[model samples]
Target chain A: MSGTLPSDSACYVYGIVPADAPVPEEVLGVGDPPAPVVPVQHGEVAALVSEIDPRRPLGTPQDLIGHARVLDAVAAGRTPVLPFRFGAVVRDAAAVTDELLAPQQERFLAALEGLEGFAQFTVRGAYRQDRVLREILEQRPDVARLREEIAALPEDASRYQQIRLGELVSEELTARARADADELAARLGPLAAATARADSSADQPVNASFLVAEDSWEEFERAADGLAATWEGRIDLRLLGPLAPYDFASQLVDARGRDSWD
Target chain B: MSVAPRSSNYMSRPSSSGLVDVIDLILDKGLVIDIYIRVSLVGIELLTIDARIVVASVDTYLRFAEAVNRLDITQDRSEGLPQLVNDMQEGGARHKTRGALEGVKEKVTDLIGGDGEEDEEEQEERPRRRTRPARKGREQ
Candidate 1:
């Protein structure tokens, strides 16, 4: 399997980092055999990769985990890694060096230099469902009156009222969520080097990732905690952090590669 | 390595611990070289769609209506509001969302059937790989 594998092998690329950055030896890469991850260097930048058989499918949850595991390890080790999107596979080692690393060497190096000593943190906040509903009720007397009217009637008798109440509540929830999310951004924006607003879903009003330098991680954590306490019971805030600058690095590289096709 | 003050109202952890957290980071965010191969990820796509089903649906509307309908309008106004809010908060949306979607897995299984089991088994056989910290709230 060893000899046959490398001949037909494609490389699953985990990410790119500076050439001098240390690769975590213990981390495994994606594929059935769990290929040993190694770096392919080109001048100042290096691509972290492992061999895979491209003929096999590569989108299992495990594959995704493996991809993230390698890159996360790199980031945790204080290396500035530009993580590749999951399932980035190349024909072979030559493609890793020739097609990927060679062409993007300068750009990757510059991004890595820019990203040095920084990590990513995601802060997510959601309104306490009950509190928000009550707030809506208090703010909108008509909605409150409608709710009282609907509550007095039987479910079967107030069918139209129920639908109307649902529409009103949904609209109110969305508006409050947007306003709260904006307030969160305004409060947390200055703490980070860069920030990206993530899509807010039904329950969550605020979802954002910040690129923070190593020195300011504590400050960021304190600010996040302060927000959590102030909005306690009203908004549930959680922070995930010291991660590879996924959002920031992706934006940097994606912008440069936008015009280049294949 | 300083820990944020621990509070029940907040949480901090590595993103790799949960399926949803990893999906957000791994799915679309990253550097994409044109030379790389892009496989059709049907499973991840289905999971994403399934996750959104609870957001805006007739089921969600009915649930909201039920909660609102139960509010006793005749009770002492100020005290009743906060108490009702507390009761609703205790019920927790995360659990409700999970419970509401229990049938989704069954439907997904029925749609994918035998092939789905095989895929699930493959995922199970793999080890849980942990590498970095990801901030995810209980609400997400």
Candidate 2:
């Protein structure tokens, strides 16, 4: 079964890098069938590729992780790469060279240059239930009534009741989180280079990621440290990365290529 | 002034930090050109199906009712109604705290579905049947 795989169906091609990028000759991308990276060069830029099997499904956790690994490997070497979305594929090397690597030459080059010496930072806000509860009790009166209602419930009840109370708490906290987002920004505003807030609904706390300059890593870290100290037990602030600029890439609003997952 | 303020505000937006926020800008918000063939995965539709369980539904209201009843049942000893109400309020505060933690936990579960948030949601909708796994495995 393994021997019968096609040499080329439609391979999902991620972004192109300068030919000098020190990528391994073989790196596997998403799926059970294991897509292999083949380099396709256009002048100075080269694309990192793996075959996209239309038959095989995409966007699984494994596949997404695979996508990140390739970009990370290239990005680590200071290669200015154009990262395709999770499932971007092209017809062949010719298409990659002609369409993406060629037409977008100037933009890609500039972006690569711009991204050098920079890394990404993710900040997730988690409410310290104990502290947040205290704050909520002190801050809101309506919450008092809801508290009274919740107090009257027995310990051993249906899971439905538990979820219902969970929903109310989520709603109230989410409202508070929305209000706090501005304060959060005000507090940590000076710490990051760029930022984006994702809507995680009421159940989840506000989630945001920041892109920080590699040189300013200390400043970013210190700012996060200060906020962590100030907020202390009220909200749990967690940060991840200095890794690839996956969040702030040019692909945020433009499509470089197509893949099966789309 | 507005332009400067907004630009400054935009710059201050954490989306600037490309690392932590990579998940959203690239995957959900980015410009996706349709021509390139993306690998089609089977289970990913489940991810979307799982995302919609964020907040505020009948499931929550019923839980509120039940909690209130349970707290009522626990009222004994020397505590009067007012004192018991006060204690219940404190318990309620604790519950709210638990609920918030539960909210984040629910978010993680919604992402991984390791917990039974899905089954609970389905039970609220369906209400009877007593079966669990059917609701558990309904991947989007």
Candidate 3:
């Protein structure tokens, strides 16, 4: 059964860190008994990697988490790391440098330098469902009326009215999300070196990642906290980072037609 | 030689992230090299398929309407003042977003990294992969 696996030379790459970036010890990689991460360095950059048995498939949740932890550990140290998308397995460590790093050495160095003294912050804000709905009711009489009309009917009977009401609410939600994203950017833009917008999922009004400098981290934190308090009940905002710059990484490396999503 | 980052008021939380945030940031938003071989990410689609909110559909409309209908507009807005403070401190969007999506198996890793990775599908056949459960909260 294991006869068809690729040669024993495969390596699972976590991401690219500066050649001088310190790899935190004891960080594990993908597998049942996880693998130990080793930096495969060439010139100015090193690929954080661990040898993987080609036979073991690597999509477990733990693998994904380990991938992020390794990169984050580096980024937390203020070193610039260009993260590789999870699930990248090259034939060997040499392939990481030959096919991945050595070829793009100049670009990776430039991107890493750009990321110095800066880290990415992600803000995800979900609408307080009940409160936002109540606000929608107060603001849109038509929606409020439809909602009321549907409330009085039997489950099957009000199907159409329910759909109509939901549609109106959806429109309001979309508009609110758009406005909130813009306001979030506007409020934090001056404090950030770069800000990239992300798609909001169900119940969320704002999802974005920002790149902020080290010295301004405190001021940015305060500003974000203030925003969270201001919209406390209406929209709950959670901010996390000084993280590996994932949003900025895509733009910095345009390999394999993977362009900037923002 | 490394300690937890107690550096700034700006980077509010530690590098530990919620499952929802982790999925959004790491699943499909990082660097993709052209010469890489991939294992089947069959289960990734399940975890990420609903990461982007699809709000315009009939099912969504109905869900929105139901969520709105559940609200008692006449109720006082200030009734939950203290709870709002808690939400600001810890119950922020991450918690609420988790509520909307299916529960992510509790993640134990303090893995830090930015918002997530690549979006392309690898052309590989699925053999043995354990994806997460079906996210059916808003499936209708």
Candidate 4:
């Protein structure tokens, strides 16, 4: 319940922040009977932690949410955090200070300063099935002809044309997705200090994240909504943000983050 | 008011709003220290479920062909396909493949002896959050 703790059970590490970072009170971290999060500080860096029983493992869906909720709540507020991968734990509070924080205090401090006033926001845009299908059919005569040919033939006879039509649609979708992703980057890129994208599919054209100054959040959301309005019935776009910089901060250390928007 | 009447297709939500939005970021991302971890992941399985639709395959092609087969593309706007579009939609829905997706929830579900995308993933809207309209014509 308090930052100060008894030296017994292992410490479950959630994230790293400045020593004085304000953790929300009564916030419980990963466990069945969740333990109250407490800070273990070393000079300017601190690890947000809670005591956990060594007998139990930490990989439950709720545990993942709990871990993220703690870090994201901090990110959503004022304090900037470098989120540690879930399931990170050290033997005791001393190990958190001596082994974790003390060894890399300067690197952690610099990363925190770099991210002091910013948070991560995500953009996901998926093509509406009905509308996109109509566009494809209208534009490609070959595709339309193939559709008709398949319809006239027996249910199983037009298998080759069916595959051919699907392949063409897939090709067209890939090209369109590339163009849309570029347009999306051009629109949202300037507003963000930095940007990173996730893998795009024919169905979902853009999966991206932006690092924006906290004060400029309203402006960014405005642009996203505008894009959504433009493609309202064609492509569905959603904005999620004030996140814990999971994308941008991947550079701080080697982690299994998502691949680029390719 | 800064907000005007917008369509039901899209909207923005906070990062804390739901697990569906950031599940991958929470699990696959963040800083990893090679130093120490005492928690035993002995029986826990890592399910790297790709939720995105795999667009290139004979089956997907067949589905796409079938979906296009339903479109009444050449006719006038209000007069074409009629209710045939609905039938095509049902046909496509019947074959919509979510083949690879099991996600962090499924991985953790395996660890705890559960079956699917658990509580938060299934709920479209959580209490105290704004109600999300059911997505129309969404790929199920």
Candidate 5:
């Protein structure tokens, strides 16, 4: 499957897996024609790839979905996959095999083996804005007093007070969010093989990914459900997973090299 | 936002439909092969950069402040101060505050000549990418 495609058509790589692993038959890759997904092998590892027009801009929602779909499909098929970052394109299948698959075969094989029975589960928690604000007001008398003072003033005249109130609220929210995120991480830490905290946004207090062994998935879910019940009305929790170990795979490959996994 | 009730199965299907979920997984989390070419994704770069621009700005602070001030007017002033605090603790207060904040956000965006609706429209107009057929028993 190498060196046959036109040079103008590059291979858009989705991920890499063991060469013996079954290719997900139904998956189509990124592009207007929706390039046929195929595997190019080197040693024990193979790259999941498809042809793409290199010149086309690739940020459309469809393109994003297409990239994710291919990777997710591989994971769903029970094969370990090391997903490539979206928009990973190469000159052609030959380059994919020679540069990506051949040179990195050992590392890829090790990473894939390490991730064999694990999948990524992302747990996102956002505060019920109102409840959090209420909690803050109850905790901070100064902020509550300031809020009252601003409320008493004329709308047009309370500009400085409004700014102060905004600053205080923002600060308090950040602090509370930090505490809550830590609490969540601590609670969920034992259930996973490894955990990584995702970048937090304003509303989301807890954005974390856990690399979980497939056997422990039930235990993890039950624990999460219990925590959700305990924090009901305070934090809204959403769990997404059984996904490709995207967050962990890249980190492991970079941090320890091929020998670390063994 | 209440948590969805736990289903019996442990391996929940991924929520890949929302734009935020897609961006979080695709752009931010994935394996990086050092030797390969990284394609310049024009729209993603633009969207991610633009999304960060409006957050935590002076406009957002003023809006938050304004919303707090408006909260006093809509609630019962006749009742004692403690009663007012009690009322704010309830869900009604949340809805009012959220609505007020959202209103201010829209107004501030309009005042700054930002076309929020046009961005949404452009996002909607982008062609839908095809996905694999839903696996049995996992359809949502």
Candidate 6:
């Protein structure tokens, strides 16, 4: 049994930081087999480090929690972080600082700068099935045929049957969401500084995160109120923010291979 | 990070404080750089697999069908299925039309990136590798 076991290697990663900041004593990195925070200092930014056993698999709920914990912990302290892509690890601290961190200093600095004093807000809504369906059937007979066909399926079915059904329903729902998005965006866009649209999940009918200015929170809420009135019960809207600008952060990298944080 | 589809839209009033989309803020769209000597990750191949769960089986279809069935039109006549389906059509249509069917690519490492690496000892707690969206997708 021991012979069959895979070998573990140390995994290193970097996470959010303020510009030209000192490393924190208790920096943590992602995984169930948690890694301690090691600061990989480039000119102004630092990559969080941990000695991870390379043989282990990452991305379990615990790993997700581990990742969130480290960044959240740092962000909570008001450190504007340039979050790294998950599964990022380096050989050692020196390489992390020189090759990874140093070269990307400008990008990191810019990212930190862009996010300063601003935060991210997430808005999610599920289709009010009862209301939406009623509205849909009343409005379009063409869709009704499809809906009627879906209704005819048995309660107990195979896995294959279910995926197909999910696909159809998802399509119908997305159609409604797109229109709803137009109306919602019209009302909500002005309130946000930037936005990222995400694919909707079964539970999350409309998944969108908005980057809003810190001072304009009240106005943002008011705008949501107006949207709620306009859409009524047809669409649901939820907002969460005044936190780190995680969503607004871009994935574009500069010449140095560092992400453009700003 | 591509979005998942199939769950029907809701009729309830939009939530005032939408924290459920929190996953969106953290998942993708962050920064990643290869600093100096790239840190040696453990079993990343396994980790990525765990994070990326694509829904493309019969189960997805049935659930979608179920949600569609559940959408009763007898109650309110103001809005019909066609109009609602039309609204959702763009969203769902894209699902079928686009070749980009990559499901849930979690960059859990940065936002939730840490010790998620699967080791032999932790396998017991982990659920089946093929979760197939199983009737219920992650609720917002």
Q: Reference contacts recovered by each candidate, as fractions?
A: 0.29, 0.09, 0.35, 0.37, 0.26, 0.42
Off by over 4 Å in 6: A1-11, A19-29, A33-38, A143-172, A199-205, A225-233, A242-244, A251-262, B1-25, B34-43, B49-65, B70-140
lDDT digits (tens) for residues A1-262 of candidate 4? 1123333356788888889988757665687678899999999989998877655645545566677778777887768898887667676777778777887887788788778878888887666565777787789888777788888999777788888987898778777877888888889888888888766567567778898887787788888888877777666677766778887775743322222211
DockQ of each: 0.19, 0.09, 0.22, 0.22, 0.15, 0.23
When summed lDDT is taken over every stretch of 10 residues in candidate 1 chain A, the lowest stretch is A253-262
Candidate 3 residue spans exceeding 4 A from truth: A1-5, A200-202, A254-262, B1-15, B35-56, B77-140
In candidate 5, what are the lDDT values of residues A51-86, reduced to their tens digit? 777656555545656777777777756678889877
Could you arrange the candidates by lDDT from highest to lowest? 4, 3, 1, 5, 6, 2
Which residue segments of model 1 deviate by more than 4 Å? A1-8, A254-262, B1-11, B14-17, B35-60, B70-140
Error of 5 at A120 (Å): 0.6
Candidate 3 lDDT by residue in tens digits, A1-262: 1223446446777888889888768866565567788889999988888867666555445566667777777777788888877767776765666677777787777777777777888887766666776777888889878877877889899999998887787777778888998888988988987788875434556888888888898788788887877777677677777678888787765431122321
Against the true structure, candidate 2 has what lDDT?
A: 0.48
- In candidate 4, which residue ranges exceed 4 Å CA deviation? A1-9, A53-57, A253-262, B1-10, B35-56, B72-140
Candidate 4 vs. true structure, TM-score: 0.74
Tens digit per residue, CA lDDT, model 2, B21-100: 22333454321435332322111222211222232345444443343333432333312112221222212322322222
- Per-residue CA lDDT of model 6 for B22-96, tens digit only, reads 233454546644332343323354332223333344544554555556654555543422323322322332332
Interface RMSD for candidates 1 onward, in order: 7.7, 12.0, 7.0, 7.7, 10.5, 9.4
Cα deviation of A70, candidate 4, in Å: 1.4
Question: Which is the leading candidate under TM-score?
Answer: 3
lDDT of 2 at A154: 58
What's each prediction's TM-score?
A: 0.72, 0.61, 0.76, 0.74, 0.74, 0.63
Predicted candidate 5 versus true structure: per-residue lDDT over B1-140, tens digit per residue: 01232483322223342333545665656776544433322111211211111123444455545545445433332221122222221111122222222222223333223322343323322322212221121101
Q: Select the stronger candidate by DockQ from 1 and 2.
A: 1
On TM-score, who's better, 3 or 6? 3
Query: What does candidate 6's lDDT look like per residue over A86-188, in tens digits?
Result: 5666555555665666766787677676666555656655555567655555676765665555446655643444455456555665577776666666677
Q: In model 5, which residue pairs have backbone atoms overlapping below 3 Å?
A: none
How accurate locally is residue B110 in candidate 2, as Cα lDDT from 0 to 100?
33
